[model samples]
Every structure is written in C-alpha cells, then in structure tokens.
Target: MREMNYFIVGDVHGCYYTLKKLLQNWDSDRQKLIFVGDYINKGKHSRKVVELVRELQYRYPGTVCIKGNHEYEMVRYIEDGTKNSDIKENFRNTLMDYDLRNKYRDDVKWMKRLPLYYDDGDIYVTHAGVNWLGLRKFKENSSWCVLRYRGRLKRMSRLQVFGHTPTESKRPEFNKKSNAINIDSGAGNFDNMSAVLIDDAGKIRKIYTEQIRKEDYH
Candidate 1:
C-alpha cells in the first residue's frame, strides 16, 4: 500500500467515459495520475478524451504523460502534413473534431512535447520501448516494444510501466521483466480497460477486468 503513490492509467484510446468512471475519487493532491499515452483514436470520444486531459493538466498542473506512437504520428501529420499512412481514417476523424487542422496545431505540438522516457525513482514509464538504437536494425522508435517497453524494462533502476501495444487479454501477465509492467489492454473497442500500479518497493499490481456481457458490463 505504501508505494509509488500514483494511480497511473494506460492508453485510454478515446474512452473518456470509461476513464471518468475509473477516476472516481481520484485526488491529485494525494495520489498523482500518470497517463501512459494514446488518449485518443479508435474510439468515438477523442475530443472528449483530449478535453479531459487538457482540463486535468490545468487542474493538476504537474501531471505526467508519455509519447505514444499515435501522438508521434499526429506530430508528423502536423509537421510534414499527412500521407495516406499516418493513421486510420476513423482515428483522424475523431481528432478532427478537435480541429487539429493547422490553426490548432499547437495541440499536436503539446503532445509532441511528451518525453520518450521517464524514471520515477521507483518506476520507468514510456509509450514504447527505448530503442537506444533508434530506427535501424530494430523496429522503429514508434513501436510499443521499444519506446514503451525497453526504455523502462532494461534497467534495474526502477519498475517500468507502459502502454501502446494493445494486450489481447485483460489480465495481468508477468511484466516483460520482473520489473516492468505492460497495461494497454485495448480500451478502444472493448468492454474492459486495464492498468498497472506500482508500490514504493517497485512491485507491480495489476488493475484489470474480464469480458462481461455488454449488457451487464457497461
């Protein structure tokens, strides 16, 4: 119970309603919230999701977020303009509601400011693994395994927690290493959401769910 003291959530994937539900009683002054990225896309409420994040930033002031590949693609679209493969249309459409079409490009700039890595004395967090090697022989820096997984897991300094690679299930598995936890069980289209919390000792505790009938689940 005496641990990381923060309740960190994983890629919300535009499920603002779910996030709101999960965040009930969250007190910023007591327990901090760390969002592991991918707060938008693939769900129907990207604007709502982003707005919640914006408001939280204002209210909480020192909250933390990491850069997910989705946000990276968003930066690319803003910087060099979109190509056919920036991301999916539905996702872009969701963000379009936020009017990220240049005049509001600052939102993307804000997103891009998120760092590729973080170490919290007791944990490391990222959207993907840290490919010390960048995008050469290994997968691109955008891949979850590198930008979200490695940067946090490879070291013994702290527990690593992340999102980005959607887990197929909603249960806790052994972290990639004894010290890292992956919590991105897809919240985009599923009835379940997932997360990981670390204790002061850097031990991981999983917060997850099982599929229930949609009627009973929501």
Candidate 2:
C-alpha cells in the first residue's frame, strides 16, 4: 500500500472562493484533507463556505474537520442561548448567513459533534496547539485548550499542526524545537487562507495558499 499524504488546511472563516482555489492543489486520491476549522463567521459567505466544506467531506472519505474556538462559541450560543456579548458578536455574521439561506439546525448539529483534534500517530492536527503541559494533560482535560490555546506549545513526540491564532507574518510558522506548525494566515481577516502538505512521516512538503477573494470576504 502507498503511504497517504495529508493536506492540512488552516482556519477558514467563510472564505469560500479562497478555499476553493486552495483545494486545487489537493490530490484526493493520495492526500487526506484535514481542515482546522472556523468555517464560518468574519466573512461574507459563511453559508457557501460551510456548504462547500460539507460537500468536500461527503466526497472525501478521508477528510477530517476539527472544531475551532469560533465553532465552539457559535455552538454555545445556539445551545445555551447565551447572552454573552462577545459570543454574540462573533456569531452574528454566521447567524445572518444561515438565516438568509434558511439552513442552521442541521449544520449546528454537525458542528456540535466535531472533534477537537486529529491524531494519526505521526501527526497531530488541531484548531489550536496544546500548552506547555503537553497532549496527555490536554486530552485529560481539554475544556478550551484544543480549540483556543495560544502561545508557545509543548514539545511532543509527534509533529503537531494547528491553525487558530493567525500568524503575524501572514504565513505559516514552523517551530523546529517543538515540532509544531501554525498555518492560520487570517483568511477571515486581513490575510489569505493557507494550507500545508505533509508526507506520511509528518514532514512538511509544501505550502498552499489562496488570497481572499473580495466576493467571498467583502
């Protein structure tokens, strides 16, 4: 059997066209697609972005979509009916998109079930990198670490790839000492969406990006 490569995507906050262009680099037959999440909000096409991601997941059996902090906030808002201003503000765009499209219940249910991380032995993918305490402690009590962790991460046995805090350089940042990478290029904000290709051994092979299209973000 041939070794499967992985295309780990960064935070995609409703940059539908940008993500579409980025996936042009993906080889579905040889590469597993993994999205770090935040598929909605902060952009104009949240509905289209979620629909496209859902379609991709259905078409690709190897696709993995991890939960993100934005997803957590939206889920909490929907389920708990929170009056928290921050959550409301963060979720407003997504809510408006869903309302306009008349699709929310099913997608919210799907988001509610999203996993916090993906660990395939050699590579670990999550929305956010773990803290200095390491993955074991994170797995034991992962209230917010998996989806919201920031700053320096703990060195781990396997390479950890995550996307949550957008890199200041507008590019993916790799930390050799910790064996980790941050791929968030602020697709929902000022930068482009980015993804990294890695071999079965967890070696980064390439970086792919798509500049945010005005139609998708504006």
Candidate 3:
C-alpha cells in the first residue's frame, strides 16, 4: 500500500486561470491532488472548470473529488426547480451560453453522484464541513448539506480536510478544531481567493493566490 501524500485544493469557483497557475506553481508530477469541490460558481468559466477537473481526474486515476454546496444547489435548480434560480449574479453570468448552461446541469447531476468524503487511511476529505448538531445521524448521502455537513463527519478517526466556509478572515474566528481544517478562503465568495495543501500529518503546507483578482469577483 502506498502512503498517501495528497495535495488538497480549495474551491476553484471557475477561476481556471488561477487554478492552472497554482497547479503550475505546485510543480509536482508525483503528489496526488485532492479537490474539495465547489469547482464552479462565483467566478467565470464554470463550464470550463468541470472540464479541467474531469481531465485531471482522468489523467490521475483515483484522484478524490467531493461535491460542494454550489454544485448541489445547481443540480437542485436544474432537476427539481420550477424555474431558473434567481439567487444572484455570481458565476452563472458567465455560463449564459446555452451549451455551457446545459453542461452545468449535466455536471451538477454528475456531482450529485459523487461521494461525500474520501479517506486514504490517513486524511479524510470532504466538500463542506462535517455536521456538529446531528453528527450521529449523518451519512455521505445526507439530504441537508450546507448547514450541518461538517458536523456529520466529526467522528472520523483521522484528520478531515474540507472546503466550503471561506477562511478569508485572518482573525481565526472560524473553526479552531485541530481535527478539521477549512481552506475555501472565500474563493467562491467572489472575494479573496486561496487554496492550501495539507500533509499526511494534517499540517498545512502551502497557500496559493493569497490575493483575490479584482476583476474575477466584482
């Protein structure tokens, strides 16, 4: 069995350029890249975003991926909603093309089928944080995701890495738990963007693209 040296990335949010830039900076032909999801939304190139992810996943077999809230919501809007979602401007603006919009719906349904977590015998990876309120009742296919997802997986014996709640605030007012780490860094907030890699020991290694592009967000 191979000891996992995973390189986990935060929410890409259609920042394909930045994501490509970050991957280049990482400069590793060896390390496995694990993505925590929210690969679309809040930025341009959502259609391009999923394609890249799929390409990489194909290139690297067994690369772990979990679906995020944005992905979950988009699928809901497509499969169950009576009309198009009227939430906000975010990344969907860039997906106005008919083909890309249809692609997003297909991608979302695909994302819905993804596993909620990945455990390589050392680190556990998830999209949103595990649920805390009803941890006992939580499962990978749980219907409620945004609110109580993290608390759901708190019982995992190993370190859990997740992205959803942005870690943009430097004050550290967010989760201080040693077991779970958040790396979203507001990339999908249409604000500051960041992603980090965690070692097998659950230590944070590097954070890329600390500064958000003014044009990408607003």
Highest lDDT among the candidates is held by which one? Answer: 2
**lDDT of each model, Cα atoms only?**
0.63, 0.82, 0.63
Report the C-alpha lDDT of model 3 over 1-218, residue by residue, as the tens digit: 54445677777787776677667655355467888888777676677778888888888876777777676666655665424466445534644642434645666557778666777677777777666553532353464453225333354567767777665472112244546677677766555555566665666666665455554555
Candidate 2: lDDT of 92?
A: 73
In model 3, how many backbone clashes occur? 12
Candidate 2 Cα misplacement greater than 4 A, ranges? 83-87, 100-102, 135-144
Q: Which portions of model 1 miss their true places by more than 4 Å?
A: 1-4, 83-87, 131-145, 148-155, 176-178, 205-218
lDDT score at residue 16, model 3, on the 0-100 scale = 70
Model 3 TM-score relative to the real fold: 0.78
Candidate 1 local accuracy as lDDT? 0.63
